[model samples]
Target: MNAESIAIVGAGVAGAAAAVRLAERGVAVTLYEAVHEPKPIGAGLLLQPTGQRVLAAMGLLDEALALGIRVDRLFGDTPSGRTVLDMSYRRFHPEAYGLGLQRGALMGLLWRRVRALGVPWACGAAVESFQQDGDGVTLQLAGGRTARHAALILANGSFSRLREGMRVRQSARLFPWGAVWTVLPAPAGFPQIELRQRFRSASQMLGLMPVGKAHAEDVERGINVFWSLPVASLDGWQERIGLQPLKQRMTDLFPEVEPLLAGLTEPVQLREARYADVHMARWHDGRVLAMGDCAHGMSPQLGQGANMALIDAHELSAEVGTGGTGGKDDWPEVFARYTRRRRAHLRFYEQASRGLTPMFQSDAVVAPWLRDRFFGWGGRLPYIHQQSIATLAGYKTGWLWGRLKL
Candidate 1:
């Protein structure tokens, strides 16, 4: 047990970024993962300016930009060619743009940074539980292995079992709707700088975003395509309705996507993703602190999950480095300040995601009707238009206040 060391459980985006940030600050960090060989999960994601700043600070932005496509706008329309939401990054800033990248590419960059910094990574070391006191925290691993650290960070995920024992007020409710997504080769003549989506009421929605490439060795570019489905319908979907029906429904709405769907033969080609709306009264309890999805998971309507996690890593590392010496005594203050700094930003996004999800994905018949009828007009308003772009850029801290300067 190293009295000056900190233990972080989970090696996903948040955990890995935290390790890299903390280690770069001259802090001793040990990252633990449950999998023997860890790899990035999910298909693709959009990296906003908030996340890109963190990557730039870590010296990985150039490589990330090279592996991703610059998205200038997000455009969504209905089957009848009625525009619902069309927000452009240029409205926020002339040079502002979102980076669409494969999840694996981002993870690879972070993992390489972790190894380069000599951070000790414990593969297959799952921390099942922990007990914290005034002195320090003791972590219990799966194989009866126990270790001590000055403090503990729970970055496992939104579905973390360890968070249940944390004595904090929290709730994790699984959303009824989820998505099945995959990355495929981009179709010819597809808009390279736009994220295009089509909706058939609130029941059926499809999105196609250009993600440059998964690997550098690949010759062709790629596109990430996803379809919204009820979580209850995911199990035995292939057996019950088959992929053709799903394909037919999507093509009927957006025929241009047929070329991209041609290669998806098996259900296994698409991965099922279930979301949860997580709310915590606070982010820390004594020596244990939660960050990333574990602390405040919400719907992906705003596409801020990875960006917020990266910001979490940046903020936590900054606070810990300046708040106190690398000791157990000062961690409480460090955690408190970190929570305060992130409270407004996290709350705004959580509330916004919750309020907007049903408009795009639900069983309700009228919600989508109203969304289609008014959303485009509202987006055209002067004040609402700028604020909408700000929110999409991951800069809004509250519904009416706070904007990140980037």
Candidate 2:
């Protein structure tokens, strides 16, 4: 499989990461993107250890670290601002640290690296259809262009069209709530702050993450305000997304945290609330394989989205490098092996993230008290904090890096 040409669909972090890894191995790679230019649509992202390791592996860690903020701890709280849990990224994965950055910034850095690695890419080109023979797969682009490769990696994301041919099943869960956020001016001489999460209810949680140093254009010049809540749908999003409404709501329910809302002068960005899971049952049939959100979508509560995608790239690239001698018949074994190794970790994170909703949203009188007690007790036990951090940080060894020793 030396110098095998591989087609990678989608250019998000997962697709780009895969493309970068394959190209670094001297594999001829062509990346396809439906969008003319990748743009940031989501809010901020926290790169857990898994993601950080992938970036470090690509030699982009220092660059990313410079553009982001490293919070010393993860602090969970109630609407009343009672601290529920406090843990740090280092406690979870001592080898690496977690940092917060805008989704767009991360993509921009990856895009630069992808081009520098010499991976050929076709933007604004949709994959209309694809067919795979025993030897390779041929893809038809939206504008009538075509490309052929020995293998195809579908990192096209959750709503991937390629999943149709793979015959994968998908299920969605709508939490009847959603979130919206806006950036604000950072305070002058403000101290570095930890990421904050406040549970207003089972269907709502607010996260405030410090992404970078304050800029002049950010009004009020204090910090970014991410106000998320559970809503029924888009019908009332405009009203609910208003700064006044959000400010009022926070003032009523979270007086302690409300003072921070005074700095939220920027327009609120409303985001719909929906969750889904992708079950390919088989990741590859013939030369096509799905990774990242295309393979499995988990709630953001765990903040493992980017982390899981990077780990997928790391493992997939390793498999491609080691198992290239294998023919198409070998892919099923490879996919099976990949699935077997990742399924447990993915499920663990999924369940762990899902479990957070109940604890955060429980309106029971005793629930908040219990949650506070749990955090207080956990804080007293540093080892327990470390174990919890490792699990959330996605630092499992052997299965991930193998003997790469990184």
lDDT of 1 by residue, 38-95 (tens): 9765778999989999999999999999899999999999989899999999988898
Clashes of 2: 15
Best-performing candidate as measured by lDDT: 1
> Candidates' TM-scores?
0.97, 0.83
Candidate 2, residue 346: how far the Cα is off, in Å: 2.3
Expressed as tens digits, the lDDT of each residue in 54-89 for candidate 2 is 898999888777777786777877656566778877
Q: List the residue pairs that clash in candidate 1.
A: none
In candidate 2, where is summed lDDT lowest over 10 consecutive residues? 397-406
